[model samples]
Target: MSWIMPRRSLGHAISQLLLQFRIVSAVARRELQLRAAKGLFGVAGVFLEPLALICTFLALRILIRGAGEGTYLNLVLWLALGFIPFFMFADVAIKAIGGVQKGGDLYFYRRLRPLDSLMGTSLLTVQIFGTMMLAFVLGVSFWEWEFVVENPGRLVFLYLGIGLIGFGVGLTTLIIGHLLPIVAWVIKSFLRRILLWTSCIFFPIRQIPDEFRPFILWNPIAHGVELLRQSCNPAYPAPGVSAVYFWGWVVGSIGFGLFIYANSEELLFANEPLPGLDDGDADL
Candidate 1:
């Protein structure tokens, strides 16, 4: 009787349990709707940080007129292009943390996985805001600098690299947020400061002293920024970064994060009760 149950039936059940693509998509859509409900306030809050940054970069360009050799306009465009990925990275870090905490509610649903819920929210934000940010970048480039998509191939590669880095970082942050909910704010703040200074956001990497260059070059964000600049600006100097290094970081970080999540998933549920469930021993 058991043998006659059919191998296809078992395979289908395994696929459903392993992937749960439908559940992830549903959760992602729900997250998008929740965020969209906030309307303009949500829109403004999402873009304000990046907008202020662009203004500040432009202001500095004016203040430093005649102070250096590089073209200010080129630098502004390059910085803007590079900053988009960094902003995405930072957003992932912060939001992944929030997603973990907020996702306690979904844990009550037996079919829902914690990681799937977190990933769904993360993907929702990426899909919504990522397109908007990319459009804004292209619009600004076209209107202000007359930039055009000369090489679609390179642009596609650039986006692939950026998405890989973002996913790896976001997954790592989810694990960190789950583990250290209390000090997560402090940890994020400290990392943001370090990333800002080391990422060469305001200046060229060459400007850093030789003594500190070796250490600063270890930052994966720097590699991401450099790659973005290379894709955007023809005249931009190649930073001689190894693509292997960036990909390695992506693989390593995501692997570690998944291992942590798998090992501690039950603990996460045990430590924090699901949103609606009142019983102590309810399945997570």
Candidate 2:
């Protein structure tokens, strides 16, 4: 006598979603193929750029204070630790905003979706940069330098939190930028530049003068970098950093981004231009 339809199980839904891993992998493979075309070392472009920047800074540090056995190792590790996370966040966020437009042509294929494009770019970013971090760590290990981890689990969570912040910002910005091309340009020029300067990439948060600590702590990335340094070296002092606030930014960014994205996903596929594109080009 029951007229109700059978209920779909959450477990089944999760399993089905997990199956999409294949799609993610396929898209990621295509990106890798394209990058590989640049030649043998071409695939390393993203990682190399960041590593080069860090080394430039390290060279300056070495020149100022003559290199000792442990001095270069310590400085390099500290810079690497901060650089990896910040660049990961920056790279993913920036690509996420433009992922749709750049790969819009791909979504024409039945298996691809808007989120798939973002996921592919993110995967590429992580793979290249993550491998770069591993190589740097191994080089240090080869020299037998001591870089003990105080909280391995916390370090991982914090790293992921930074990545989440990037994904969230990218997602939210992609949606807004999809509708308003100018919004994307403004953010690309301003917010990212501010974050790069203030994220404590070259120095520790504790090293900052007290006058600037308040403003610096407001940047969750500053906290992320400082906390990462302390995790690598307990001697690194970071008083103003707060895990709660850092995680808050991570959660808020992802939540807001998903919310906006979900509401406006249709615009992602509208071959017709979004609103702000005066020239009939809504994609930024």
Best by TM-score: 2
lDDT by residue (169-284, candidate 2, tens digit) is 88988889877989988877655688888998766676679998898888889999888777766666788888889999998998999898888988887766456667664356
Least accurate stretch of 10 residues (summed lDDT) in model 2? Answer: 65-74
| Candidate 2 Cα errors over 4 Å, as ranges | 1-8, 39-50, 60-73, 145-147, 273-284
lDDT of 1 at 191: 54
lDDT of 1 by residue, 12-121 (tens): 89998667878888898787666656656564554454566656755676587633524533544555655566666666666666666677778778878778887786
Among these predictions, the greatest lDDT belongs to 2
- Model 2 gets an lDDT of 0.77
RMSD of every candidate to native, in Å, equals 5.5, 4.8
